[model samples]
Target: MRALALYGAATTLGSLVLTALTAAPAGGAAAPAASAFPSFQGAPEAHGTELAAGRALAAGVKFGKCPASEELPAPIQCGTVKVPLDYAAPHGRQIELTVSRLKASGKDPKTKKPVARQGALLYNPGGPGASSMYFPLVSGMPEWKKIASAYDLVGYSPRGVARSAPLSCMDPKDFTAAPTQSPIHPSDSYKKERIARAKTYAQGCARKAGAALRHYHSLNNVRDLDVLRAALGERKLNFMGASYGTYFGAVYATLFPSHVRRMVFDSAVNPDPGQIWYRNNLDQSAAFESRWEDFRTWVAKHHKTYGLGDTAEAVQHSYAKVRAELSHKPAGGKVGPGQLQGAYLQAGYYDDVWAMRATALSQYLKGNPKPLIEQAAPRPEAAKDEENGNAVYTAVECNDAPWPTDFETWDRDNSRLAERAPFETWDNAWMNLPCAYWSAPRQQPVDVRAARGALPPTLILAAERDAATPYKGAQELQKRLPGAALVTEKDAGTHGIGGGANACVNRHMEAYLLTGKTPVRRAACAPHQEPNPVSLDRHALPKRIPAAV
Candidate 1:
């Protein structure tokens, strides 16, 4: 799942496309080797091939100027690390993964010279397909100033992601060539159409990406991360991951516990092997429904400002009315029921945008649909990136674990959930429909449990009301990782907690990263205050809203 901004970087909904452990040691003490741990199911043996690849990356990376990006304005260095396309055959074809770094620099308080460096801190911003090459630049943002000054901030585009042998399914124009189709349709005909489209998309991926799709699962991603660690010349990895990234960190820790220095998992995915992905998506749908109620109530409480409703039910009616009207006649010939739902889905992920979204709804109700239209309109320029993200999302999720091949199972499960949780159930189902027809051979889900006395102290951050990765998942991760600590933002519904507006959450994260000090086993922080109502000026809204996987 795509995470909200890791350190409050401004991310549009378009950018985010849309884990666990056990603990043994504390600090950086060496743990048992990979052979001492239980084997990961369907994982290639950690022998000659893997070791050779690691040695190759240890030759070191040559830094150079990074590609220009308005999204990443910091003076960052970029390079690539070559790894096997398929780890099982490391001597075969190689793929280059794009990497970026923001070298740490800060003066010592006592001495006039630079402070001693604290090693590299690698970041993965979720997306089993999101390009994290810009994350190093994101680390340079003020929210991460302390961490950035201590460690070299690092980011990379994982296999099959942008600048890393990106996977492509169809032409960029095809993404916006047709009017958006709402996934909430109740008709059997609509289901058939969606299934057909899913098949077509899957076929396109097979045609374009070919056999390389088979090598893009979590196991390889974990392997790639290790190679990256070697390329950085770090004996141990200091890391932070959010959303699906939490799972990535968990798998890496499981396979290479001795290599972990300090790690942080924000908005963790459920670590149960049974919930690899499909069941987790269903759970996400229900959680989103709950968060949506939170949004509705917020709008109701501020009814005077929005004028759309005075009660939660009234707000729901207003939303339903707007969705119906958009279905019949799309606003500005672009934003349809599908686009409208996509726009509002952001509210389920973040409360910061609630006021602006509510104001847009009010304007639409007043016959001025421009605000709503602007919110949902597609950016043709971003279509290619979106396509790459979607392709990787399906490729990794589908390849990472087993998914039911039958459409009937998906239809029944989602149809039943949609009755009670209407906001994101259908939309999420359709987003993952491509998985049902995925052509890549699937692997068994990684058993994320770590060996006894193997892992180091890990910190997990979550919001009690997170919709993308629910609060329960964090609790589950805490259970799975023996010595880990969980710091929750009580009653908060935001997807990503660390490096956010919550000072308490940031304190816990900074403490853990800077000093390897974890909070009490189960700690809680007060939620950030809910946003106050605002005027209808779209520009007045906060530019950043956490995007979900």
Candidate 2:
């Protein structure tokens, strides 16, 4: 996915009983040594010392009332949890993680009286880089009332993301100076340019982030999460994570099976360590291509309104024309062919944004570029945060397992895939190119297998046509966690399935969260109503497009 295109849903979600849940270039630096934390086996007791140490660290947690924010829908408490910079050297250095919580309402809606509160329901929005601080506020929404009244909604910006000692790897200008990854069908020169740019991006991170990059992997973030759980005083954790967050939850479960009270993994990530960052992205290319067809078909179905085309192929031809035109002259002097692809990629993630993105495309095609330009405009204040997120994303992903050190391997594999998977093949690759020169040392991926009976029942949500985290990953994850059951949206394209408009999905999740019941076999949910085309007028488009991983 393109850097800008990788944004997520705009809606907030809450924790529930069965409830569901849920990079840059530069120079060559040798891959470092193994992580201080050894590879985890199925034994949760193996990490007892670390878990205890994490609890001890929690004793020092300090919380203060959160200052009110217009952006936040509900009041939340904000605090910091300090953890060792390197768990192996507990006393050497420490970093603070920003944590937030919306206390359970405790008042039963029917009784309008206090009820005993359940433990915290911690959340991660799967960015490896998305700020989770806003998650608690989601509990205030009416849809989340059941969960909001039952458990504290907890959110924390994982280490190196948002306000948690952010690890920014590039200057704001350099970060957005070009597409974070290269476009497909590149000429040989363009290919060389991309490789060089990847190197430059990696070197920039090494220079900017310094040694802290070493400690930014998911293993560490998972450890930090345990600390947060300890600090929150929860004997076991209940979690909801989407996209990459699903992977995080899986790893957490693998490491601390006994500590998993409840978990809902939406749009689950593949746990195959061998694939690492590369193969999975290749999978995304095909998945997104199929989703693009879905978008095209939607556009074609509304040919009378859009006037783009009467057929999916013709609609694609029109889109290609827009891309070509923008390549020559960027709309409003900003959004180019690449940026256009990035913007429209959102269409593949969710049907909610299909109309908005299509409207922008139609407007651009009709010689009014304002919508497209505005869509691509940068937020300078957010640039640093984006950089930090990207940095941490790379830190965790690249360091999670072995990535090819040779650029040729990247070029050869991507070059071959680009021919067949034209939409995002190259874009996905360049997004992960920094791994070729990542400065952090690599570690063995956690042996995620449980002994079939080791883990608590986990509810897994999968959208059959999800572009980012493909459905197959969910299937694999379900197999890996014997107690876990999978809920699939029949033909939904959205990345995050739960808490959306699907009543079927919501009911199944509620059943699991409230009663700890998962399907004895795979269960499928009907897709939500397909979005109807809105007025083509720019003002009629959605104001808050759903974000995706």
Candidate 3:
């Protein structure tokens, strides 16, 4: 499954709202001392009593200059924390986690005095593999100003991610080395090819990552969160997680209920151990199919601008024509039926890009392939990062729970779903197919329901029509967390809905985070209006569309 993509956007209120866009232990063998690295001047000092068993681990953190990033406009402190690779063997091998922080304070314009601070708010952008280190970039946005002044916004690249003892399954070039294969194809040969590809990828991971693959599951990640909490000197953790991060937060609260002060789950994962991961992906297929229909309807309504079709059926026909053409001769010698599906997959996540995508399709049908090629072609520079994300995503999910070892079961299940939920069924199945051949031993799913009454009043946010995490998961999660409230973006289908997409939802989140007041048991906020074709801005298209959540 893909995690949430954290993007920043300025709202009408002049505040920066985070918009959906899309652990472990100490112990084992001795590692290098923190003092060996040069210390950063004026960085916040570690506080709070350290864990009795791993006091040395918590006390050894040292901060330094962060890697320069074009994504981050302001400088933030960065550091590494050593964590036990296997919590059961605390004295065993250790791995380093890259941590970053945007402090909670700024000068008051007139008085030029510093604002008071109120603990820290840690964030995870849900990729199981996504890097959260750049999350603090939202600090200067108006919507984030209040939260920024009150709490230090902290982020970290979890185990197996970039600069955090990164994991790799194959060389960067190998990621795209395979010829494009369309998931929509129904032939037996296609299935055989996909299975072979999945097995090859798994073998590569085993060859390269070795034993590290077994340690990147959710359990170790939750343990790492505790270690980070202690390192930050906070007795109780304050966190906001989206997509898979919701699952991460729920597991943390279950494992360390006493250490949670305030937590938020946006676009929550269904916590039913029985539904975890496999069933959940199946759910996404149907939901995404529905959202795709919504997109076709929207494009149909704007036929004058797109000239593709004036009915959803007609639009779909136009799309099929483009797919057939691509399958015959890939646009720009890169985009094929598979790439075409990949580019349009963004429509299932966020409707904001509907016009841009529709425009690209319309242009392609009119004999211009530039727009479609630009949207579908992969960039060489991003190959490494993309590979890293996929590796971690596969490793964590595969290690976190048992997947059917037989290919026959997967084929049967997905083939049934493909009949009705054709849009994402096969593609999603292929994305997770590597799990069947995963080398690591699987662990049992964490029982989040075990934490029902033991947690703080956490807030949960979701869009009713969210295809990625699906709204039902949010409702399921609410039942699993006793005091948590569910705030729904009524009639909306976007994934990751908390930062500033809707003012009503934002108000509820702010109230809960700032004052510990959970909204009424359930709340609903009117959805954002659909995009207008007449006023659509072509240049506003995101350079890269985020993958599934």
The model with the greatest lDDT is: 1
Q: Which stretches of candidate 1 lie over 4 Å from their true place?
A: 1-45, 69-71, 108-114, 183-185, 535-548
Query: Can you write out model 1's per-residue Cα lDDT over 1-549, one digit (the tens) per residue?
Result: 432211000242112111001112222433233343234464454542344334433356787887775245557888888887877766578889888888886653335467657888888878677876766755545567777778888888888888898898888778655346575646899888889988998899889988787888888888888778766766688988888989989988887787788999999999788998899999999999999999999999998888878999999999999988877888898888777777788888877778889989999999899888787777677788777888888788888888889999998999999999988888788778888998889988878877666888999999999999988888888888778999999988887777888888888998898888997687889988778787445555332213336
Which pairs, if any, clash in model 1?
A: 1-549, 2-549, 18-549, 19-269, 21-481, 22-481, 23-482
Q: Write down the TM-score of every candidate.
A: 0.90, 0.88, 0.88
Model 3 per-residue lDDT at 419: 90
**TM-score of predicted structure 3:** 0.88
Choose 2 or 3, whichever is better by lDDT.
3
lDDT of 3: 0.75
The model with the greater TM-score, 1 or 2, is: 1
* Number of clashes recorded per candidate: 7, 26, 17
Deviation from native of the Cα of residue 526 in model 1, angstroms:
0.5
Off by over 4 Å in 3: 3-53, 56-60, 69-74, 106-115, 450-453, 534-548
| lDDT string, candidate 3, 347-420, tens digits | 88888778878988999989999988887777677778888888888889888888888989998998998998
lDDT of each: 0.77, 0.72, 0.75
How well does candidate 2 score on lDDT at residue 120? Answer: 81
